[model samples]
Target: MKFFATCPKGLEPVLFDELQALNVEQPKQTLAGVYFGGGLEAAYRVCLWSRVANRVLLEFHRGPGETAEQLYQSVQEVRWLDHMRPAGTLTIDFTGQSEGINHSRFGAQKVKDAIVDQIRDETGRRPSVERLRPDLRINVHLQRGEASIAIDLSGDSLHRRGYRLKAGMAPMKENLAAALLYRCGWPDKAAREEAILDPMCGSGTLLIEAVLMAADIAPGLMRKEYGFTFWTQHQKAIWQDLIDEAEQRREAGLQQVKSRFEGFDSDAKVLNTARDNARRAGVESLIHFERRELSRLSRPTGEEAGLVITNPPYGERLGDEPTLFFLYQHLGERLKADFAGWQGAVFTGNPELCKMMKLASDKTYKLYNGAIPSQLQIFNIRQRAVPEVVEVIDVQDDSAEPAEPTVVELSNGAQMLVNRLNKNLKQLGKWAKRQDISCYRLYDSDLPEYAVAIDIYGDWAHVQEYQAPKSIDTVKAFTRLQEVVAVLPQVLGFPAEQIVLKQRRRQQGISQYEKQDQTANFMEVREGGCRILVNLQDYLDTGLFLDHRPVCLQIQQQAKGKDFLNLFSYTSTVSLHAAQGGARSTTSVDMSATYLNWARKNFALNGFAETRNHFIQEDCIKWLKAQKGENFDLIFMDPPTFSNSKRMHDVLDVQRDHVELIDLAMGLLRPGGKLIFSNNYRRFKLDPQLNERYEVKDISRQSIDLDFKRNQRIHQCFELCRTE
Candidate 1:
């Protein structure tokens, strides 16, 4: 029997090779598939194991057909009853055009009519047309005056491995992903037990395909049915034997394959979907998916150097080309900085972006992602060594094994730290529950020996260890941290992965705003009618001030129908609340472009559509002097206590400069407006003369929430207005 395995263009060579590997007789390559002679077992094997094939077709007949009636007669000549029962569902896929049949759908209907009419005449019953899932699917092709009829052995396209539950913005098909890897020589690398990584794995499709290849697991094993299962010529015994053999090989392959497989995506949702897809693929345990940006991508430690492959977004919009260039450049920098002695493959639709990578391609293969032309650019990363410390910041080594501890489990200080955390959790957990709070501080340096601040953000925890004083013993501090890392996950019922650790130290001014790392791991937590995004890993502050919940709510309440102004707006969470409160217009001012951009995203997340909301990038103090015609009815001013940085021209000390700052800000307040001035400096004092100039009432105690009850001096807030 002559069979044909069809695939998308540019994959015919791989498909032809795949069929030969399956022991098909005299396989030959064609435009979009491979042609071969095969019987029941050979056909079943090709359908089950050919990753590059789109459909496996069993050719039955070919005849001359120039007109509709001639096409019908040609199709009628085939033995339709032997293949499909009268009550069975059938679908016909017709392609190409002829002199009499120009439209594909019209041609398909004529062929369908021929089959149904013949079957009905033979048994007095017609086979129904199933548009979606049919018991038997037929493929009819006509060009010039020739008609060829074949039964599709693979019901659905083999590209769908039945694993992907969700796709990212743009997704590459599984078949194309497999072909790209095969073109990159993944089979040879897997045989050598080398690792595979997709640094920009949006939905983990590439990594999932790579794992299937490494484990020798057949992709078709995940599907419950195929076209061959509904065929009359299919031998059930032979099919079951192949399935049983595949299962045994899958089990054994998983055990024998030690190659590390992993994926990284910047989007948390994308990473989560990747995990779900891997889980559904039955290879969840074989791969690692983590939330990470391309800029911070590092080498997977403790794994054999093999290949780094990715299909980054090829921005298709009018203005997307420039942004892709930036991304491509960043990707190249990361690849050069970390991945040494590894093969790299990047499949992208836009060739202009490839120029930004700066690395010359060792080999390039032409491919297509759907209709858009794409290139699979490959490069070889030569091994180079220089620095002892890797440039990647906060990089977690996935392959590292914990050392067997011969040291004591817990020291005297370690036990005290654990006990304090337990006491704080018991006390604060109840308070948080009663207050309807999703985020709060659990512990804040309860013991000087174990100086740590632990704050819970929904299911996650942010732990900041205060830089131990010089007088403290280094060994004890090390032991204290080791014990905390080991014990917190067990005591809190929260897994260790939920905890983000950082060292806390006093920054004299502008240093606090400096970026600790370029990696951005953002998550949103609910704060009273607001969903605020926080970056737990890349900054000194988690974007949202947990103690300032009351202030944020207060701003919202007073903002109705008012023109709101927010100064030194770290992330503009207060401005976001104001907009939620029906503010007529709101303007947020800050010096950091990063925070301003983040604030705009916050507004976008809340679906704020009005153009009245605005963000300005300028030093709050400098910008205040320029404010003349713009009068705000509600204002929030929360400046850093000390700021001496290169970004700002003026060095500011809030304590020494509070009077000028307050006078300038109040100048823009309308006649009946309110000004809320706040700062966290414990020793902050109000100017005596301002009391006579305006109505100032210290609302510090009322503004403090239960979470900060232990530290009442966490912030000082005042309601100040014109003394009308």
Candidate 2:
């Protein structure tokens, strides 16, 4: 008999090897199914032993099914009466489509009508249709104009494995579980009596599948039924012989299958279902199940080098995506610590979340669990090989101890660059941690050769390389940039993805106002008891200014119960701080609608979404001048020094406009209220006229952060109020 074994989409190659092992005559592969020449006995062997095959079919004939009449005629040519009792039930597993038959149920009905009509005409009796557990399941597939008909030798899908009692939230399909294990080299490991573990084994599907494969227990044997046994062509002696042989080997295989299998789940009830699932499969003794949290996962004592494979939650449930990143990171760190020399596989739909693992995997397979596309990333959990940090620059005078002979070779210039970055991070990183700071600038072009700023945001690093001067050689400049890119990930211990690279160039015209990207990605970072959102990408500048850190802190201390106005509020980071400090009302004015929307998100993120927090999208100068009756208790005006924005009626030069801008802001200030004006113009001269008109105090020294001490001219600040 010529037969076909249907498996999951990505398991074709796996099933082919399985068919070959079952002694089929040269199995030929096809989409989602494989074809082979074999008799009833060989088919029975496959139906019993193949772990990946979903169905076993005995193809009867192929012909045109472009029309209903033609489809019926094609299905009628098969000997239906021979495969089913005259009164036995039948069902059609119709797949694919033809131009004439678009509806699968309609096509199946037509095919069923043909079989019943033919069988009744021959013997005056027809088989009844059974949708569930049919004695004989016929497979009908029509593609274009051709139709292929077959009798399903195995009922239901072989993936059923007859073990699962309960499938947990987002349960992985059994066949996909098997494919993951196979891809991770479990079968080879099983032969060596190695161990297997699934830390997030929700209902223990992977654990049960592994035990069944190792024990040589036929997945089909658990269920005492087959589509072929009742068929007229089935040879009882041949079928019994296959079963008898499997039973004999099963006893011996049980002794040979010494590989230990265990599973852990956090939910107690779900863990119980996994226990029940194993009991039903009769491999409960071959595996162990426990209600254990993922953070506590560890290899069993005395376990040999083995495989750690799991299908953790993909965080597709609700908005749990971000939280799973930490879980993957923790799992990877624990695996590296405890399970060195073992193979690992993580099956997940969210490839972006895989970045948290920090392990490199060269082999990845694209597979599908139902409609969800996923990747099975395979990696070996061995010690990460640390490359020797080779020193390229001979900065040492003969007195310096020879540096370890391991640094990556680089030009003398690049070597000096890495050395300076290393030294800066050593000092800055220590102090930042001592101050409980998760985000801080570690290096700032301390060496002219490395004109890049390295800022640590949580576990990620953001590198902003200053555009080289025109006088510098273009090729050499690019080479240095590449060297910085290579050294940061190595020296700083961050994944390349975690390190965002952006070229910072002085913007002219309205180019600075344009959106670089629409990603709008923002992350909340803490500063002085308030959470502020920062976008490392999609902009020329990160939303939060590192140099203005102290200014934001001071705002929080002074903004209780005060009506606050934030002018030129790029992302409103300072305004958010004011709100956190119990500000009664806040009005943030900026020309860019994009920044206003970003500020709104920051408000929402900080749980400060009050009706009184207003975002005005208009030119700050225009908005300030339009305020006639309003007087604010407190105000922050941080204007750009030179903005030639087309959105503005007149370009702003802080040196020329500071007097008017500070005066307009002072006019809106109520009695005892303060106005803080700041700018980043290196040559900025605060009009002496403003100092004469109001009580002005230079707080520039007070606003600069420890990290920005070297670049004191980065920004300047002043506190102005109406003269009494």
Candidate 3:
């Protein structure tokens, strides 16, 4: 039989790869989907093993349709009666793009009407529409003007994998989450001294999925029923044999895959859910679940190297910005301090929050959670290199009060120490200009006796002075000093990556962590439509953070005729960009009346109508709470990092309170609407994870940019859709 394995967009390659690894034949890719030829056993196995596929559908028929009536007629032409009994319950799902037939529900209704009419006219009985559990589930795709119908052989969405009897806020789908870990090069062997960890394991999806994969356990093993079982062609013996074979494989591989798999969530409720999910998967004894935040993660005993994988809360989930940044920064510090020898992997839709991890990642892969394009960045944590002392010198001042040193002038109108051999500023400037470089002269003797002057392409200057020189010979050596300063611009381009050196002695016994340097000039880039201008420098954060890049692109692509709302509007980036992309109107909300004012400035910068843009300085949750029936076509939300708002009725934390926010926000979305929610909290998890009520896609990859080169995940971006 021909089968179509539905996977999240961008994961088709991964599903194809898995099929190839399994030696399945004739695998072909489709848009956001894939197709292959296989038998019932192959179907069962694919459902069990394909990590990236959401569901396995057995293709039944196809035809052309120009209108809803034509679609109904085409669907009725299919031999549905021969496939299932008249008394069996069935469900119909409609998807894809088709002119004059955009409503999936209406499409599904038409198809269902056709199927039932044909069945009842022939047999005087029709299968009932079973939404939750179905005997025969059919998927109808109407792309362009063509319609294809398929039988859902797996019954429930394959993500129901039976391992999760319980779930916490925003638990990940089993298959996609599993594929993410596998893509990270998760070792197949279970006894290889590898440790699998999820620092923010909401219901332990990653941890449970990892364990199942390591043990080679079939995902379908725990499922009690399948759609194919009700088909007239069902083969009882063959299905049993396949199940037995899968069990045998699991038993054979059990001892070979005894690695430590662990999950940690700060919420006790989530921890309980994780425990229940593991128990339901029948791997509770093998996997350890704990209640701990990222900051509290400790090195597991006897583990030299292991995998630390996590999906942290984003700003939308944990509604405080500063707290989220600090949380991420601390997570980075903890990873560096505690798990120096481990391999770390963080999965997030937010690139800005990922930067908080600070550790440089070695590899990054793009994965999709529904429609959201996310990044899985892998970091190889190693001990920091000890700083080498180049030189040491003793300074002695003989004067009772150090007499002011006399100034000396050199050729080319440059000043320097009288006896120093350092090159003149004018010659250095000439050499830099000749080389077409943005940086050249650094640190010349001028003004105060201890002062040193530096020039940056004549555009900027940095001057520093020291009370005494501990390494005068090292400072005076032009050849070695030039090489050191040149290496900075070579590795990181001049002007783009330039640093001035300053040395100062701190009080004894004081330890200083890396201080964020914030002295660079900020450059703004007008996002394609000129609605949003993002500053690239000044701080580690660039003007426009990348993880939200995809969502913005989606807005530009889909925002026609849509009224946009931007919550917690920092600099009104999304609103401005959306408006510039042709959104009808925009409303930006933030508590910091200051940020709302800045948002207005951003709108004016984009030449958008001050009348078309609405700025609200009220608290978001309260505002949302107050607006009972407000609806929008497009809503972009990135709540605070953490907050006491929900309790105080003033602030909100996206991670702790996203379910309420999402629930509230969904009410504010009009029929056939779209909402893009994001957060920068490193461990933000979705609350009351939505299954079918709305389509949720992680769009984090498109958010990354050169500014977040050190760490890929800076934010988590999610696209939510409500279809009429």
Give the top-scoring candidate (lDDT): 1
Q: Model 2 TM-score?
A: 0.56
Tell me the spans in candidate 2 whose CA falls farther than 4 Å from its real position: 317-319, 384-724
Which is the winner by lDDT between candidate 2 and candidate 3?
2
Q: Write the per-residue lDDT of candidate 2 for residues 259-359, one digit (tens) a residue.
A: 88989765567878888998998778888887655546788899859888888766675125544554676567667768888888899888777776778
Say which prediction, candidate 1 or candidate 3, comes out ahead on lDDT. Answer: 1
RMSD of each: 18.8, 13.9, 20.4
Query: Per-residue lDDT tens digits of candidate 3, residues 258-367?
Result: 58887776566778878888888878888888755443577888877788888765545432443344355556766787787788888776657778667888988887
Clashing pairs in 1: none
Worst 10 residues of 2 by lDDT: 386-395
Each model's lDDT comes to 0.83, 0.80, 0.66
Clash count (model 3, backbone only): 55
Sort order, TM-score high to low: 1, 2, 3
Please state the error at residue 24 of candidate 3 in Å.
1.8
Comparison by TM-score, 1 against 3, better one: 1
